[model samples]
Target: MVLRAWPLEGIGEIRPGDDLAAIIVDHLTEPLEAGDVVVVTSKVVSKAAGLATAGDRDSLIDAETDRVVARRGQTRIVRTHSGLTLAAAGIDASNLEAGSVIPLPRDPDGAARDLRGRLEDLAGVRLGVIVSDTAGRAWRIGQTDIAIGASGVAPYLSFAGVEDAYGNLLAVTSPAIADEIAGTAELVAGKLDGQPVVVVRGLPAAWLDSDEGAAALIRDDDGDLFGLGARDAVLAAVSRGELPRGFPVADEGDDLLALARAGTDLSLADVTVAADGSLEVRALSEDGAPEAHVEAGALAERLRILARALRREIVIAVVSD
Candidate 1:
């Protein structure tokens, strides 16, 4: 219940050959306890792991990525070598040379494990470790640090089947505690303040355990309901594109139009109504202009009201040219 954060400074001189855990321990006034979870930014880990290279930032981004999920001109969301979908493949240009970019550690979980082992040896206490990085969220503004790698800490706190105060069974109640802890720790590790390490104390003792790493926070691609489709995935494949697939597809008519509007661009003329009260839709411009011969169905009627209000009616004849 007691959460504490310690910001370690003067770490700019830390190089690839430097011992990061040793540096952090030297900066700490108090020894880390068995239950304390130390959150280290991935930037520092990458620096210590020699993940940086001299090359075109874009080229490095392309080299580190498995696929481009989404792109808006020069900006892209990519699935990186670490199996993480993030902006620019988590290639960082800040705090480094003009032509140099820092890629995330090849294995964040391994970084956390190694750090934990070193700390245990140096401090003589079994402790938890988390490697964190800043990431943006869908439909959210601002960025927060999340645990990309963890050791001796539970990634999530499950509350499934637990009853509420009213005795209602909780169906899904798992909380990404590791990520939450990382976010809390970031408040102390300022972005440009050279605070790469933070000591988190007063977390629940139960969270202290040696099990799987932060991999638990990652949802399986297939089992995820939010997993995007070929077209949608291609459109939004960048950065956590796998988690927004919730909510039923808009009911094949106006609802679909609404969803499209929220997720993509849509014009009123994209939909049409036929003489028989059926609804015909031309989802893509490649699908061609609305045809008069396409029949309108019951589902179309619900959407037609909105289409009509928007003057989306198409008057083209169904006859082939």
Candidate 2:
């Protein structure tokens, strides 16, 4: 299947309460089709919704962040209230007047739905709308545009239960279609090009007319394997606070090499994998003194807590002198 995408030119600066649908319609160089998807940058949506504020950027980020996942000097990766894990809570500080920043639309899905309705009426054709936003991946460098809001577009395409070319059953091969479209559109909507809208055409007809929004792409903490960063996972396990997700029950032969890099003073000799998937841990000290035993017990308790958080079984023993 072939697809084509082009950014809408002549779109001027969007202001609060502007008719975004009309602006896009006016700037359309070609007619839209039923399967065409209109991708709008989240920054323009925020501006049209009057979400730009002249407040402290840090304060805005703090307010938008639900929890800090990781921090490196001045940068913080945080999860927002809307379940998006982003750097600086997806606040856009670029291309705006000094001291003014734009936060993502409070309800991107709803915004997309509303925009789709308006565009459909104006264009007289069925359409899909997506609100795109820049996001960084935990493991990958740099960023990409992803679908923060979507309407009339299938959020994901599941290939589960399908047979591959080699006749292998595909169990968990769902591709996030909305995000793919957003990223595809971003290729034409250059970052500094002032092009905030792109129209993607030639998607499968069935992919349109779907009600699933982009929110379906978000995996809650329980299901997300990387819910917490490596350092954050260790800190959460040590604090005995609400264990941030990510650590799952261990299976046999699961090499827990991550524990070795957890920034703890404990040696590899202290932790071992049992024959059955459970962990066997020796206390930190090997002295016969009562104080040493007490310290060992305390360390063992901490390991127990970490095990419980991970929902894995652990056998703890005190070291002998």
Candidate 3:
């Protein structure tokens, strides 16, 4: 099967309350085909919705984040209200004028659905719409576009109970086809090319749908193995004001220095306590239980509180590796 993806040019800069659908329609170099998928970049959607704010970046980031996943100096990963775990909650500072930042659409699925309706009416063809944004991966370098919002497209294709080419039954084999489409379409939508919309044609009929938005791509934290960054996992758990069973206590001299052997059988190395009382705790995954940091964080937080009571500075580092 052959597919074609081309970005709509000359759409110009989208302003607040601009007719996004009509703008794309007016810039169409060719007509949209039936079953064609319209890929819209989230930046333009934010601009149209006036979500591009000059507000304080830190406050804006905090307002959009649900929780911090990890942090090291200036970089941080966070989970947003949209159930998406991304860098800075997908609040980007690129492609906009300096001193301004753009955030993803508050309701991208709704935006895609609205755009799809307008496109169908103008072109008189059935189609799918995917609102996309660039995102980083957990264990991989660089970034790729993903479906942040979707309408009239199957956000994922599950292969459970199906056979592979080798005739083996598939179990946890669902592919996020919507993200794949968005990523593939991104090839033609260059970063500095001013191309925000791409028309992806030639996907299977079963891939198109009238429901199932991009939220389908998000896995619940309860079932996600890597939901929390190793350190943040510990920090969040420790913030609950509880310690792991059989861990150290502050009264027992288990201060910031006690984390080296904090876990009963867990051993941490390169334990450094900074002048300001910040800690750097590194643990190899092959060491004790992989999830020891969660408990370790709890242990560290308990000690940190004790230090604070004594008017001392304290911080702990639990390397996720």
Clash count, one per candidate: 8, 0, 0
Worst 10 residues of 2 by lDDT: 246-255
**Winning candidate number (TM-score):** 2
Runs in model 2 deviating more than 4 A are: 243-321
Q: What tens digits encode model 2's per-residue C-alpha lDDT throughout 172-224?
A: 99999999999998998888899999999999987989888999999997898
Task: Please list the C-alpha lDDT of all candidates, in the order they appear.
Answer: 0.70, 0.80, 0.77
lDDT of 3 by residue, 1-321 (tens): 798899998888889999888898899998889999999999998999999989887778777777666664467677787778788788888878889988788888888898889989988999999999999997899999999999999999888999989999999998899999999889988878899999999998988975989998888877788876665455334344332221111222334344323432344233556576577555535667645665556545555654554345556666555
> Model 3 — TM-score against the truth?
0.77
> What is the C-alpha lDDT profile of model 1 across 13-38, one tens digit per residue?
55887898889889888888878888
* Model 2 root-mean-square deviation: 9.4
Better of 1 and 2 by lDDT: 2
Worst 10 residues of 3 by lDDT: 243-252
